[model samples]
Target: MVVREDSVETKHEAIELVLARLLRLGSLVAAALLAVGLTAMVVGLTGIAPRLITAGLLVLLGTPVLRVAAAALIFVRERDWYFAFFCAVVLAALATGILLGRAGG
Candidate 1:
């Protein structure tokens, strides 16, 4: 099975495009949520404002994790074991940190 150089480049480019779009959409949604939350707070809709702000912050924080997961999936699909393994390791570390933080907190 001959994997052409151009095909490899195309795959990488596609991965990058997908990742970029993911990040952009995540950021836009988080920003919109945050803005709306702030506006609601200013308008005295205190009941839901904090929840909205928290949701926005959680989305912002989760974006990078999602990016890593996406990259891992892409690499796995491409049969790029090295990068897929690296992504898995990073995800494991992130999960460990989160668990430890929660336990300590």
Candidate 2:
């Protein structure tokens, strides 16, 4: 069995590539949804258009959050436990804030 070792820089670069792809994909999906929503609205199909718009907005909002989560997973893969733990903590805090905000609303 052969195990290859990667330097920390290489690990970070790998994660960056993954994050870039994720962002690009998220942007594309959000744009498509927004376009559809706009078209629907223009054509007087009011029912689903607003829902699609909201969904697109949500995807745009969630991209960075998902990126952070992916970073945590990549850290775990690279055996960087400290970074992984901190990222997890950050995610937890974000989730708590969202929950609290919703409850208050």
Top candidate, metric TM-score = 1
| TM-scores, all models, native as reference | 0.90, 0.84
Best by lDDT: 1
lDDT of 1 by residue, 1-105 (tens): 466646877656678898999999999999999999999999999999999999999999999999999999988888889999999999999999999999999
Candidate 1 structure, TM-score to reference: 0.90
Query: For candidate 2, what is the lDDT?
Result: 0.91
lDDT of 1: 0.93
List residue ranges in candidate 1 displaced over 4 A.
1-3, 11-13
Candidate 1, after superposition: displacement of residue 2 in Å? Answer: 9.4
RMSD (Å) of each candidate, 1 decimal: 2.0, 3.7
The reply for model 2, stretches above 4 Å from the true place, is 1-13
Q: State the lDDT of candidate 2 residue by residue for 1-105, as single tens digits.
A: 123454566545687789999999999999999999999999999999999999999999999999999999989988879999999999999999999999999
Error at 10, model 1, angstroms = 3.3
